[model samples]
Target: MRKIRNSEELLGQGDIASRRIVLEIADRTLDRLDSYRRIRSIMRMEGSVLHIGTRSWDLSKKRNVYLLGAGKACNHMAMAVDHVLGDRLTRGVAIVKISEETDRLNKTEVFVGGHPLPNEEGLCASKKMIEIVDHAGPDDLFIAVISGGSSALMSCPIDGISLQDEIDTTDILLKSGAGIVEVNAVRRHISALNGGMLAKRIQAVGAELIGFGISDAVGSPATGDIAVPYAAYKSTPIGPDPTTLDDARATIVNFDVADRLPKSVVDYLMNAGPDKETPKAFLDNTYFLLNTLPDSCIYAKEACEEMGIPAIIVTSFLEGESRDAGTFFASMAREIQSYGNPVKPPCVMLSSGEVTTQILDNSSIKGHGGPGQEMTVSFAITAAKTKGACLLSIDSEGTDGTTKVAGGITDSSSLKAAAGKGVSLYQSLREHSCFEALSAIGSTIFTGNTGTNLCDLNILFVPAIEGGR
Candidate 1:
């Protein structure tokens, strides 16, 4: 299936050739990073033995097999495992950001949870997972599928902390312009399920854990030999947490959100003793690293090569304000087109990372949008100087911020198109309403439940200058 649902509409406007190339690369890259296909390739069942990568487990010797997962990509990951285990799987519980109609599961129960913020439904689903784990014994086997956004999708706050507190904390951290690592640091400390706390619980019961994880952390290295056991896995609910309580406290102080965050969260992070720290390591559990942040760029570069388009992976660690990044891409396009500084024009620049948008006041939000939408809007404004320069910025998980769409695609003509429709791109950025502005110009890209979550995947296509003007 096509990952870009609105490709036809997106291609009809501003720099059609460039938009087509950007969308094509994006479509192929998303398909390559699909967790469902990746999981199926490395896991299967042979008689009573479970084969994953280079390891094999005799289920006949185990009492029961259980599946537990939560994340934006859990729908596909959990479905793959459910199909593999079949009836041998005793029970399964998966909390996903959006449960698609295409999802088919036999024994796994699906829960539609919130992302970017924890909700009551996620809290309930988390409680159910805890119940399942508490009853499990040493003879039981657990297969965990974890990915980015699990921190919010599987929400179970520790004692003295409320679910709303976690929700508020997440919202605050996301808007505070703090990087995802710092935000997760604070979140992992207060949650009962996150920061390897769930793995600790399973370990306490002596249950065997086999983890399939996709690391969305920025600057995460590319994974190799995914079938083998990964000894360096960390974070999420199923692995050891690399973050410390001190890190969490430091984030609060650094972002200066202590007054805005819930008092319960502040008090817990400040006063929690060393015993309250999240698990540092888990030696007994087995883990398989699937995709990382750089995988998106790697796949995109290959796609560009297949299309015979020169492509350069600028950076996999792109960060900072979203609008500024867009402007920078525009400047890079100008240089590439005029002087071929980085690379010649008619080339594609690929980058993957988590770019943030800082909104200090809630009253400033007039409509809705995310970092991807804002970035594309800003690019459209500055890219007018370079003809046929197109940019596509997406969350890569199919949902960009508050909007239902994946992200936005815009080119040099996009700003003019917005003006024709009486939509002010500048005012939209100021109001944090890029979704509305892009939607008016038919530039929004919609792909629901993309089956991957590697944060932002940015593609910039700069066509050769028409007349050197």
Candidate 2:
């Protein structure tokens, strides 16, 4: 694993030791919980026996093994699978966001695609994926690598829905602060391969399908029911039923995303047809969760302990507005400084899970930042002038929103540094321009594609004693 590129700059600007500790924890967590490493740890091939978690597959019984995957982490995960299966793997294709960072594979072809929104490249790649799967026979094995951005990266619009329609709908949902469940539900209905539709396609050819899901959708009730190392044949279908469609419509209305939706989207939703429904049943399919947010948080906590720093995971299922959560954590740090309750100083606080940023309508605001950066700025504002506290928030995939930077790291001096540059933190937050504000203070966290996505990670470091005490 590569070091976060902006680590030095970030550490240089904050309370040096505290920032170092926070970065160390973040780097360690990233290293241990990397998607490829996690996959490699659980999978191995010995002669004809292939071991994946607790289950073993005999190569003698299987023929024509094809690998298909998509997501920010699928490149690494696919590479790992190729290494394990070696020549036994027939052929594969993986859609990823970064083509440059992708390692060469013997049998797997890596396709660079768009994220957060699907593009022409993703559409093309998804078509190739469908072609490959559609050719599978009864004796074939289809291993599907699913992860965080798969919904966007593997986009193949269903009939009557153009790529533009999907893009418009996605943009609306993202800006509306809709959760993954609702967003994915809407996507599953419009796409040709989401939900259980992929399984349905493979079943048509009598091929056996298995899903390796690295869950970025933490706290989802669906994840809890899945048995570890067990292949689930049944997947919840997202169809155009009255209940599901109503929920989808309600989400758009509730979030005020309806106005931005394209005419095609509105027409499709309003004039629902059975063709838009994803198949609920499949002949042969199974699923397993490879990694999750709590899994990564546990790794971070363990790493902190290994460094002799007392660490506690405050929560692994954090959600809600990003700024609110940021302010709350900053307040917690201040509380720790003023009083020794809830574990004293010299400890690291950890949290994981996705958060949302409700961007208010501002046509003039052109800010480059994500929810992670927003949280960092909010923390800087609330924790100003308070010494011995450092906080770092990052999207695990290394890209926060559409910005080039991952997120931001800040200390008590962060606000002072921005003030020195005549940067107003409040104005930045108001305009949702955290990227520029943190960049000016040399606090932006930059890591070019960490090759993994398991939600977001936030670390707070409180020193043993306050400054000047």
All models, RMSD in angstroms: 0.9, 3.1
How does candidate 1 score on lDDT? 0.92
What is the model-wide C-alpha lDDT for candidate 2?
Answer: 0.78
Instruction: Identify the candidate with maximal lDDT.
Output: 1
Q: Estimate each model's TM-score.
A: 0.99, 0.91
| Tens-digit lDDT string for candidate 1 (300-401) | 999999999999999999999999999999889988888887887789999989899999999999999999999999999999888889999999989999
Clashes of 2: 1
Residue pairs with backbone atoms closer than 3 Å in model 1 (clashes): none
